[model samples]
Target: MAALILFSVTVSVISEKGEPAADLLRENVEALADNEYGHNIYCLGYGSLDCPLNDRKVKVITGEY
Candidate 1:
């Protein structure tokens, strides 16, 4: 559950950048995964095609982005 939340947050926060930066972001998120289940969760997050939980969610949740 914690890992899922973290994955969601990481996906949510990833910035729009070039391929190298995206690769780095993928690496960093993958590292945080730590297990097969987590890896699956990571894949789900990545497979969302782009950031799903974006700045609008942040703004709604915390009143900032």
Candidate 2:
């Protein structure tokens, strides 16, 4: 069986409250995944480390927003 390797890139953003916003971060992540490059990138919010808004397969890492 061939293993499929996906490349995920995390983009961090700080909110007004100084907390990671999962929703907003997911939006940016989704946009990257939708890009034409097809690099399989995922957006990780530095604030919302506890709960990620994006898909589990996308590999969302949150920290230090």
Candidate 2, residues 1-65, lDDT tens digits: the string is: 01111112222234544666567556755665563333444455444343333434333643333
Top lDDT: which candidate number? 1
Q: Candidate 2, after superposition: displacement of residue 47 in Å?
A: 45
Give each model's whole-structure lDDT.
Answer: 0.44, 0.42
Q: What lDDT score goes with residue 11 in model 2? A: 24
Q: Which 10 residues in a row give candidate 1 its minimum summed lDDT?
A: 56-65
Put down candidate 1 lDDT per residue, 1-65, tens digits, no spaces: 68658766666666333223367666766777644332222112222243223422121221122
User: Which ranges of candidate 2 are over 4 A from the true structure?
Assistant: 1-21, 36-65
Instruction: Quote the RMSD, in angstroms, for model 1.
Output: 17.0
Q: How many backbone overlaps does candidate 1 show?
A: 0
Error of 2 at 44 (Å): 37
lDDT of 1: 0.44
Against the true structure, whose TM-score is highest? 1
